[model samples]
Target: MLSERQQLILRMIVEDYVHSAEPVGSRTISKRSEVSFSPATIRNEMADLEEMGYLEQPHTSAGRIPSQKGYRFYVDHLLHPFRLTPQELFQLKKIYVDKIDAMERVVQQTAQILSSLTNYTALVLGPQVHENKLKHLQLIPLSDRTAVAIIVTDTGHVENKKVTVPEGISPDEISRFVAILNDKMRDVPLQHVKSKLYSEIMSELNRYMNQFEGVMSLLDQIVEVEQEDRVYLGGTTNILNQPEFRDVEKLRPLLDMLEKNRTVFQLLSQQDTPGIQVRIGLENDLEQLKDCSVITATYHIDGKVAGTVGVLGPTRMEYRRVIGVMQQLTELLSDLLTRLHR
Candidate 1:
């Protein structure tokens, strides 16, 4: 707990440091219109705040900067909501209004807009489709021994697999098989498609097609659930523009992690809660991100958590503005995904 004066000084120091990337001095805090205290008094309070672990002195200079503890305190106790400009809100709205029908394109464009607006690395975690229901299925024969299986999900996602046509299965037989499959398996979740096919569809096919075993085996491979989440990143090179990352050595590990999709997916997918989550400095479990901060929010499809989106920047990130952007974007993303799945 801090006195009203101490909290005021701490807030000013954090806001200044975040903007300028430089330590703040007593004169700077005292000069604010809201502060009636003298520089000497403000200095005493700053010293006390430093002793309490809220601020740190980078050198022998008379200035101080907020530590990670100070940032946590500001976010928890002193932070105020940043009202976005009308233009900002309009830019975000234009994305959905333009109507990109595909989920992948919508997600990719969202990530690009986020990074472009904030000038920070942006990540959009693509939906995990393990349980997405199949809207339709089609099998097309290209030759006597080759066929293509197309799977369409209710969420507007498509997956195609090429397989060898069964030795004795004719085109008419294939059409009949697809008709039966559509009747029995439409709307079944992807992860259960193989099981449903084996038990329910297999017996029906065995009576007419002698190659039922081979066809069923191929279907099993087509519908298997993907084990890894997909991660989309935008403005990956933006980190190099930050003052803190001018040195290549300090940026290498983070750049390497970002380049590998799985690492970024694992990092952003750590949040399970419903709203925006802020991890500052050492709070992030990953060592590569200790010098940075991450803000994550989960986006939903049909009222269920489908994926996550995040902004990654140096620990000196603009929390107020970034948090505001993340909140609005996630809400819009949720709405967009719901519409896509419908």
Candidate 2:
């Protein structure tokens, strides 16, 4: 519980540091801020802030920078929502209106737009389809030993894989199997397909030669291979521009993690909450992200959360602007998804 004067001093220090990316001295704050306080008085308050863990002096001669605690306090209390300009709003609406027709395109373009708007790395995880029902399954014969398996989901996601066919199965037999499987599996939730439908398929297989057992094994492999959700990422170069990450050695692991889709998916999935979540600095579970901050907001369809959209940047990121963009983008994505369902 800081006094009013201390709070004012803290706010000035944080705002100054945010803009300049430099430690804020009492004299600098006194000169730049509207608060009419002597440098000596401001310096005394700053020393107290340092002791209280809200600020830290970077070096012997340097001024004070907001510590992680200071940033947490500022974001929780002092930061106000920043509004976008009319042009910015118009650009966002235009993009949303144009790309809402295709879910893949929407997610991809949303990530790109977020990066462009915020000048930070942006990521969007595709809608989770663990409970998605199978819409159709098709198999195209490539050779006696290999075939292409196509599985379509009710949500319009299509997955394709080249699978090994069992020995001695004719193309005609393979086609028949695909038709039978689709008949039994289409519109059935994938999560329940293994336990509920596997027995039925096995019974059908039993009516054939014992050699057909291999086909059931293939089907089990396909079902067990987890369905991968799509991910869109943009702005890899933006991290290099941030002062905290300017050193390439310090930035490599982060860049590597961003390059892999699974890591990004896991990072976003950690915030399972339904709305906006802000993870600052070491708050992120990933060690590589300890120096970064992530702002995420979930987008929903028919009141069910479908996926997440988020921005990643340095801890000194412009929170108000990024949060504003994320909020607007979340609403835009939700509206687009609703229209898709309709």
Candidate 3:
């Protein structure tokens, strides 16, 4: 248990370091009106905090920085949520007021806005494919050799791509497969669609269809579940502006992970349970993010988690403001999705 004075010192140091990206020393903290302690007394407390693992002395400098444990403790206990500023509120509200019809565009814009608002790299994970129900499937013949495959989901997302029609398959065969897919896969979540097809529809296709192998190949192409298509990122290069990331070695790996960590974002979809989630320093699964922190909030459609929106920055992040902004953005995103579907 921390004494009131220790808590006060830790809070001030965290806030100061977040703002300045520099180490915090006891003398700097003693100057605050809220801190009535002498610099020597405060230095002794800081030494104890460092010994307890709440603070770290990065160099020979007599300054201290919060350790991962310190950060976690501060977020869980000392952090207070603050309301968004007027300017921040206006920027977030502007996202919905501007017309956007496509779900992808909405998500992309959400990520962009979140990044600009927080001045940090923003990550927006679009609705998980497995969690969304199949709404409609159609195969429109462009020619005898090719057709456009369109798959619609309950979340109002549509995926369409040109697919090759095997030589032996005719338009009638295409219609039959389309009908079978819609009949069997409608209302089934995307993740289960392929399994259901193999289990229930394959035998029928093989027995009744003229070219069984060709039909199965076409089915495979049609249901190729897009696992990473939904990830939307904004301000990927924003981290370069932070002083902590000035070293190229430290910056490169994190940027690389952000550019291609689809699995990381997919796992973020599972954070459906409410409230802001804070992952500080090594708490993150990716080793690339060993020096960073991620603050995320899950947004939903019709109360089912559709995606996650998050900010990635150095562990010295402005927790109060970033968390407040994320909360508002997630809420607005949910409301926008609900209204779009309705």
Candidate 4:
């Protein structure tokens, strides 16, 4: 365990270095009103800190910077909860006030808001059908033998299916099928929609309709959920703004990882117990992510982990502020998505 004075100094160094992007020296530490230690005494402690592997002295400067170890220690022990300023809170609230309707739009705007506020790359994984409950289903006629079936979920995910309206089946019959299905299956888990449709609703529809089998087949096809693998990204180029990524060689793999959707999905979906996960330098398994930190929060539907939102930046990240932003977004996203179908 570090002494109280040492812990205080480490915290100061991490906080100052994160924003300034420069090495911190004992003289710099001494200038703070809270630090009573002289520069010489602080320098002695700094040398001890470097030996302990908590600090690194760059060859170009007499000042020292926090090593990965120092950052981890600061995050795990010395970091305090950062409260969002009133302006920050307003910016977050504005996302919901915009009243975006589709899940795609909501996730898109969320990615934009996050990257704009933090100036870090943002990734948002939108929930799939299994993570949502059925809100409504409708059919729109396109031609004499064709129609479009649209499925809307509680989380605002939309899936469209093209239906072949049987030669004899009237539009009135199609309308009835939609009404009955909505009445019976409203708010049912999407995975169970097929089972319930086959077992319960099928028998009732058989009496009036002659093409019952074909209509049921069409309904099954319409509800057969497979088209919802979506990821919204923002500020993909923002990493260039960070000092650590200024070199093209250092930025290559990370930029490559961002460009591929499947790889990003895998990265964002690292199932850590739920809520927020903070993976510091080298803690994340990806070779390209060794120097980066990823902070993710799970947004849920009916208390199940449905999707994730994350911010990626260098290890010298603003953990306190970013974590606070994640916490706020988690709650806001949950509320906005949850209230949609209700």
Stretches of candidate 3 exceeding 4 Å from the true structure? 130-148, 152-156, 162-167, 175-217, 266-272
Model 3 TM-score is 0.85
Provide the overall lDDT of each model, using Cα atoms, as 2-decimal numbers: 0.84, 0.80, 0.83, 0.84
Candidate 4, residue 182: Cα displacement in angstroms equals 6.5
Tens-digit lDDT track of model 4 for 1-342? 888888888899999999999999999999999999899999988898889989999999999999999999998898775777888788679766766876657777889888887789998887766656788998999997899988888767787878787777787888888888789999888788778877887778886566787677767777776532567898999999999999999999999999888888888877645877888889999999999999898987657676899999999999998888888887888777666635
**Residue-pair clash count for candidate 3:** 0
Q: What is the model-wide C-alpha lDDT for candidate 2?
A: 0.80
lDDT of 3 by residue, 75-181 (tens): 99999876887886786677567757656667878888888888998988876666767889989999888888998987677889888988999888878878887
**In lDDT terms, how accurate is model 1?**
0.84
The TM-score between candidate 2 and the true structure equals: 0.87
Candidate 2: regions farther than 4 A off: 32-34, 167-169, 181-186, 192-216, 221-229
The number of clashing residue pairs in each candidate reads: 0, 0, 0, 0
Q: What TM-score fits each model?
A: 0.88, 0.87, 0.85, 0.82
Q: 215 in model 1: Cα distance from truth in Å? A: 3.8
Candidate order by decreasing TM-score = 1, 2, 3, 4
Model 1, position 259, has a per-residue lDDT of 83
lDDT of 1 by residue, 192-217 (tens): 87788777767677876666776676
